[model samples]
Target: MTKRSSPAKTGPQHLVLLAIDLLDSSLHYPGDHPPFESFHFDIHITSKAEDEKSQVLVTVKIGVHNENITRQLGSLTINCTFTMNNFADVVRLNADGQPDMPDDLIETLHSTALSTARGVMFATFRGTFLHHAILPLIAPGSVTEEKRL
Candidate 1:
């Protein structure tokens, strides 16, 4: 028999956090384009708190997949933090001892979190990777691009 896993303590929130950050991004062109193929990538998120702020780490991994095998192009990651100024305002304790985050507040939090992540991305890309040979061809106009997936 298989045992079920326990639920998360805080559960899931409806208001998704749209954030972006770039960490140590690089370009590795095989001197030319490999082949016509679809792009595949994955995103990972983790959060931690230090002092008055909570650090949200977002990592993006990109790989090119051909008929034979998949090869990693590169990766971008952003290290950001969200400080809870008013914990009670952001998260309320319900009668059942569960945390209740309001819809409006959740939306606001999402925007702020995303902006914070983009800030680091902007700086790193402009300062470090702006003149990369293969960057301008594939890179977006802005650091954080808002596109429908």
Candidate 2:
């Protein structure tokens, strides 16, 4: 697992969902259909803090793959923008002027965004062959650990 940005840990921050956007989505099948042996998930989380606006934009992408992981069965990318109440406290400007956020805060936001995407993905492929290929319930740390910004 790739490490997340290890910035100074700030106290808890209140967040509200500002918006949810479906950035991209697609579904495919390689002859053999659902009820397959197994399914794999590829989850990626990335965030950008808007200190001036006291908001953070997080994108969570959930991709489903076949048992062997050779072919992609479906994918859903959702971008969620959240308004952080204590933006200044939890966010700090790095040397490069990028907003450095705490791991805990990021992990929480990632988890929420992932859950939202999961529901959307499920509804999207409903009644289709990919219906059975649902995004697995993933730990917050495990999801954000893969990638972060």
Candidate 3:
């Protein structure tokens, strides 16, 4: 009888967690607009699992408060999970053909946050500032230096 060989293990040894806090003084346009002092915005990204079998999951949360309204605008949360393989592919290709590092990963996340905020601003506040003005300020930059071959 022939012996069967065991399958090789593949994937990230440990999960990575990234947190970014976005502050927007101009979340609402017009300084005279009702002040929302209790509003809070937070985003969390987690590399749940890595390997041939699974992808990472990212969770986002936004909270707002207004003492005058019936609804206090507690917290609005959204979760997005994407495959590691897909992420890897995008990071490899930038505007120019070059190999990018994990820093690119954060940039992608920042872009996603901006997009999400824009969608929410349009739907809820009917505002145009989040996308045009606020997002640009909070966008994350490349955190690490690229290695030379």
Candidate 4:
């Protein structure tokens, strides 16, 4: 899960005809029990949408570590390519007022891609990561941020 949160969009009246894929994912290490103390994430997209049909390549990299600063606990890298038709309203514009892909919407799609990638990653290390690492992070009845992910 990410440290930051994005408000969920429900009853959406904008955007349609979305398609996404997970292209690649790699894991450096699965980490030990209690997993890593922190993680690192990188996300980006390469777009080609001249006719409003966009093909985007999204990537996500996660580096995991524990209290030990020098050694890395684990890492995950993922790549995805998706095509979608951007709604007129959500599209960002250029200097000349010409329409372009919205960076924010692209970012939102990146999260969706990562979510699928993360699901696969967690399933890959079901015994180690799921049981020893992620499950322990949950502390019930604690006042915390919204639980949506």
Candidate whose TM-score is highest: 2
Tens digit of per-residue lDDT, candidate 2, span 94-129: 655555777777778888898898888988889977
Tell me how candidate 2 scores on lDDT: 0.75
TM-score: the better of candidates 3 and 4 = 4
Q: How close is candidate 3 to the true structure, as a TM-score?
A: 0.39
Show where candidate 1 strays beyond 4 Å: 1-21, 34-37, 53-69, 88-149
lDDT of each: 0.37, 0.75, 0.39, 0.42
Give the TM-score (vs. native) of candidate 1. Answer: 0.39
Per-residue lDDT over 46-118 for candidate 4, one digit per residue giving the tens place of the 0 to 100 score: 3433334434444545444445445554454555555444333344434443334444555455455556556
Ranking by lDDT: 2, 4, 3, 1
Give the per-residue Cα lDDT of candidate 1 at 82. Answer: 38
Which regions of candidate 3 are displaced past 4 Å?
1-47, 50-52, 66-72, 84-101, 120-137, 141-149
CA lDDT of 63 in candidate 3? 41
TM-score for all predictions?
Answer: 0.39, 0.80, 0.39, 0.46
Which pairs of residues collide in candidate 2?
none
- Candidate 3, residue 33: CA error in Å? 12
Best candidate, lDDT: 2
lDDT of 1 at 8: 28
Model 1 score (lDDT): 0.37
